[model samples]
Each structure stands twice: as C-alpha cells, then as structure tokens.
Target: MTGKVLPLGLPLAIGFVAQLAISFTDAALVTRLGARELAGVTLALSVFSMTMLFGLGIVTAATPKLAAAHRSRDTGAVRTWYVQGAWLAVLVGLLGTAVLWQTRDILTLLGQSPSSARIAQRYNTGAAVGLPFFLLYVNARGLLTGVGRPKPVTWVMLAAVPVNLGLGCLLTFGAGPVPGLGVFGAGLASTLVRALVVVAVTAVLLGGGFRELALRGARLVPRPAMLLDLARVGVWIGARILLGEGFLPVLAFFVARFGADATTAHAIGLRLESLVVVFALGFSGAATTVAAWARADGDWRALRDLRSSLLLIGLVYSLGLSAVILASSGFTGRVVFGLHEPKAEGMLHKLVFLVVAYFVVDTLITMSMGYLVGLSDTRLPTLVVAAGYWVVGLGTGVLLSELTPLDFYGLWLGVITGGCVIAVFVFARTGQHIASLANSTTEEAPE
Candidate 1:
C-alpha cells in the first residue's frame, strides 16, 4: 500500500511545489514591477482563472469515468471518453473565451484604477487567448490519469515549470533581444509555455503513449450519452468553481475600497495562502483519481476505504498547515508579500488566519465532493455552494462590511463562512447518500 501510494503522491507533491514556484515567480516579478502592477495583474489573473475553470471542470469529469473504465480493461470506452472529453474541452474553451472577450471592458466598471484596468486588459487579453491550449492540456491529463498514465503528466509538468518560470521572467524583465513588457509580457510568456505543455502532452497521448488505451477511430467520435452524463457533473462543478474563484475578485473589489496598496496586499495574501491550500489540493487530486477507479470497478468497499483515507489525509495536512500559517504570519508577510506598511502589518496575521480557516473547510469539501463526484452525485453539492456562497456568504459579507470594522477582512470572513457552510452541507448530504447506497447494496447482496 505504501509503495503504491508513494508513486502517486510523490508526483502530485512535486507538481504542487512546481505550481507554487510558478505563482511565487509571478508575485516576485510583479511586486518588483510595483504595487499598481501587482494589483493590475491580480485582477487579470483572477478573471483569467475564472474563465479557465469552466473548461477545467468539464475535463475533470472524465477522470473517474476513465479510471473506472481502465480498471475494467474497457479500451474502447477509455478511448471514447478521451475523444469526447477533448472535443468538449475545445467547445467550452471557445465559448468561455467569447464570453470573457465580451466582458473585457467591465473591469473598469468594476472599480479598478484606470491604469490598473488598462494593464489588466492587456494581461487578461494575453492570458485568455490561450484558453484552447490550456483546456486541451487539462482534458488530456484527465484522460491520461484515468488510464493510469500519470507518470507522463508528471514528466511533462516538471519540464514545463522551469521553462514557464524562465520565459515568464525573461519576457517580463527583458532578457537579451526580448523587450521588457512588464507584467503583461509575463502573462504572454506564461500562456505560451502552457501552450507548449499542451502540445507536448497531446503528442504523447496520440502516439500510443503510456500503456495505450488502444482507442478505436470509430469509438473516438463524440459520445453524446457519455458527454451528457459528464456534462451534468461538469456544469455543477463549474458553478462551484465559478462561485469559489469568482469570489476572489469580488473580494479584491472590496479590498480596492481600501486603496491600491491594500488591494495589492490582499492579492499577495491570497496567492501566498494558495501555497498551503495547494498541499491539500494535492491530496484531493489523488483522492479524486483513486475514487474514480474504485467506482468503475464496483468496489464499493474500496471506494469507502479511499474516501476514509483521503479524509484522514486532509485532516493531518490541514492541521499542520494551519499551525504554520498562524505561527509564521509575520514572516510570511515579509517574505511572500514584502509588506512594509504599518497598517498592513496588524492585518497580516488576521489575513493568514482567515485564509487558513478557508482552506481547512476547502480541503474537506474537496475530499467529499471528489468522492461523490466519482459516484456521479452532483446536484446536491452544486446547490450547497450556490446557497452557501451567494446567499449566506456574499450576503453576509456585503451587509457586515457596512455594520462592522471588517473591510477587506470582511471578504476573507465571507469566504470562510461560505466554505464552512458548503463543507457541512456537502458532508451531510454525501453521508446520507452513501449510507442509503450501502443499505441498498446490502439489501441486494446475498438475496
């Protein structure tokens, strides 16, 4: 078990670390460019992430389905899922980009500074332009993981990081013949690198890569039935992501009320907190993979065991992360955000605590949903986040900002509140459903 776990966990761990490095490079570079640039890029990245997640959610729906098919050695279904998933990614990505492009001018109306808005438009335009490539990578990865070919992803991602980091730096800061285009240049470079990664991964998949799913061309066309089933799951997950990722910019909007530097600090704090959150996500990713495989095999016992293991994993990891966030709050601010303002100092610990609390809830939510998603239970979780974030969380945040001393902190408070609600709601619903499932299985068993 230990040996089996290590192979899966280690690569994920490394990938998470590499992602952190990419984020850190962004911060370090933009922070040096200036606070306004940081704030601008923050807004850009926030929008970019929101748009990107819709396609990613759709692609993610493939993993467990593919994993389960692989477990049963169903090569045709595996190939079918892969092809359909890719086609779906392209369609979603194209549509999402169109939506984002139409909404590009809204950043100014959203209260960003004129200069920040301009920079944001530039960065977002560059980043958003790469959505198709990005979606292809995500869909391909899901298919690859489903067929137990994660090692290739690990290798490609590892290679992509250094290239991504170096190019982003070179383009932003200007190296040799490359002109320094500031943070916008960085966005361009990041997008380009991501495109390369997708191309490389796609090539590997097409060329009988990683144990070969032995895909049949006839089977490779879109499977409307399979696509619909996954889309049902995908839409709900996409809404969940939209609420979750969309809330960040809204929070940034509220923080902008505090001034540019405050907004920059909020963005900095948000990204820094992601380092801790990513660790939990690494586990979530692994759980999602394992759960999908178990579900496909009809191994209810194994599915239950996988969920238990992931919950335990999330608990231990979340606690350690909470401690680190609380203990090193000041140091993290200095190192990660480069905070020198006296006002920002007092809020740093509060900010880190709020972020940590949010992640603790998030980790549990991810574990529960990842498992339930494997079982194709989507509507409940979607409803949970919809009610939690929009009604309970965002409503309270808006009202309390007027009533209390919480300003930007109010935004973080909203996130914590929303995440807690979603976590509790999802857990209870999943538990009840799983219990009913177990009872049904038992009733049918041995009869």
Candidate 2:
C-alpha cells in the first residue's frame, strides 16, 4: 500500500505544495509591505481560493471517471472525459474570474473596510486573469493522474516556484527601472506563472504518449450529454468542496470584523496549516485513483487493504505534522513572518494549537472524502460536509465570537467542533459502504 501510494502521493504532494508555494510566497513577501497589505491580499486570496477550489472540485470529477476508463483500457471513454473536463474547466474558469473581478463590491457589501476592499480589488484584478489557465492546468492534471503519469505535472509545478518568486519580487519591490506595483505586482506574477505552468504541463501531456488520445478524432466542441454527465458528478463534488473548504473564506469575512490584526493573524495561521492540508490532499488524490482502479477490477481485498493503510498512515502523518507545527510556532510567528506587534503576534500564538487540531481532524475528513469520491459516492458526503461546516461549524463560531469574550479563539473553536462532526460522519459512511461492497462481493462469488 505504501509503495503504491507513495510514488503517486509523494509527487502529488510535492505538486500541491509547489502550487500553493505561489500564494505562500506571495504572503511571505507581502508581509514586508505591512499588515494592511497582508490583510488586504489575504482577504482577496481567500475569495480567489474559494472560487478556484470550487472550480477545481468540479474539474476533479474527471479523475475517478478517467481512472476507471483507463483501467479498462477504454481509449474512447478516456478521450471523451478529458475533452469534456477541459471544456468545463474553461467555462468554470471564466465564471470564477468574473466573480473575482467583483471583489471590491462583494467585500464592501460584506462590510469590510473600504481601504482593505480597494487593496483587495487591485490584487483580484491581476489574480483573476490567471483563472482560466489555472483551471486548465487542473483539468490536465486530472487526466495525467488518471493515466498514472502525475510526475510530469509535479515537475512543471516544481519548476514554476522560482519563476513566481523572481517575478513576484521584481514586480513587487521594483529595482532600478521598474516601478513597484506592490500587491498588484504580486498578483500579476501569480497570473504569469499560472499561464506558464499551463503551457508547460500541456506540452508535457501532448509530447508524452497522450497526443493520440487527446487529439485523435476528438470533438473540440462541447456536447450537452457529455457536459451533463460530467456535471452530474461535478456539481455534487463542487458543492462538497465549496462547503467543505469554502467555509474559510466566509469565516474570513467574519474575522475581518474583529480588525486587521485579527485578520492578519487568521491569514497567517491558515497559510501555515495549509502545508499539512496539502499532504492530506496528496494522499486523497492517491486514494481516489487507487480506489477507482480497485473498484473497476472488483478487488475487495485491495479495498480492505487501502482502508487499513490510509487509517494508519493518516493518523501517524497528521500527528507528526501537528507536532512540527507546534514546535515551530515561535520561530514561524516571530522571526520568519516578523509579526512584531504584540496583539497580532499573541493572537497568532493562541491559534497554533487550534490550527493543529483542526488540520488533524480535517485530514481524516479529506482522506475519507477522497476514498468516497473514487467510489462515486459523492451526494451524501456533500450533504454531510454542508451540515458540518455551514450548519454546525459556522453557526457555533459566530455565536461564540459575538456573545463571548473568547473573540478570535471562539471562532476557531467552532471550526474544530465542526471538523470533528465531519470526521465522525464521513468515516462511518466509508466503513458502512465498504462493508456493503464486501458483503455483496462475497454473496455473488460462490453461488
């Protein structure tokens, strides 16, 4: 299990971290511009991420579908899924960009400060330009992973890191002839790097044995039946993602009311926690592919092994990562980010333990969802996540933050509570579903 998962999961994990490195790099550099800058960019990024993640969820539906087709050597089905996913990616990307372009108006209506809104709008303008390309890259990534060729995508992403960093710095700080664009520069760099990544990955996809699959007698135009088929799965997945991960951006809106210091601290905490979150995502992606293949082969034993491996690995990895986060809290908060302000720094410290707890629980939820996605059991999990995040988590956080002295801490407490609820329900669902599958297989085997 480790052998199968690590090869795929490690590269996927590296790719995810590298992809996030663009934003993380932006945050690290933007911190030099001051807290207001960090706050504004963070707010903009939260909105961008919400939209991007939703679109990503929609596109990722292709992974399991493609994986199943590939495992059966159904070239026609593979081609169709890939092309349909690409078209869908384009459409979602366009819509997401439009929404991001309205960042200022949305922020204002949400009652955020005008200055922050204005700054966020500037950043959004640049970031929004990259939406289509980034979504395209995601779709391509799904295709590659489905075919068990994820290494190319990982390499392309790893290479993009330094390009983003150099471009971000040159545009942000301004040397000699160039004027410093500040937040806008950071956003612009992200856009350019996303475009470059898409081009590079696309080249690799075609240049590698996939050219025939992608271009041979393929319908470039969107077909309604195909689109509908993809949407049938994608919509549930998108909603699950929006509710499961989208809560952070909505929560950020609430945190904004507490002041820039709180918002800054919240943003920093999220960035640090995302490191481990990607690890979960990597494993989740691997689970999805492996599950799809196993299901296609009707291999019950493999499924059982998968569950055991995921549980043991997920627990050990989550705990180890949490410990690292706790130990490095001081260095990360003070020296690395340079959060010298007493209030902001102190609030950040208070958040470390809560962030660790949240990631641990969230990791389990992520792994379960990944396995379920591969099995094509998405609708119920979607509802489960919605109830946990929106109904239970956000509601509790709001009440605590508004009515109690816990303030910022209360918000996170609510988040952790919600995560716990999600973990329990999702794990239960996975166990029951797997047992049903095994029982059916056994009943049909001998008779």
- The number of the candidate with the highest lDDT is 2
Residue 122 accuracy (lDDT) in model 2:
88
lDDT per residue (tens digit) for residues 240-334 in model 2: 98887767756888999899999989988886776668878988888888888888878777777787778877898899988988888889988
Q: Per-residue lDDT of 345-419 in model 1, one digit per residue for the tens? A: 766666777777787788787666766766667677777787888788887777677678887677678777888
Which candidate has the top score in TM-score? 2
TM-score, candidate 2, is 0.88
lDDT of each: 0.72, 0.86
Question: Candidate 1 overall Cα lDDT vs. reference?
Answer: 0.72
TM-score of each: 0.86, 0.88
The 10 consecutive residues of candidate 1 with the worst lDDT sum are 1-10
Residue 30 CA displacement from its true place in model 1, Å: 5.2
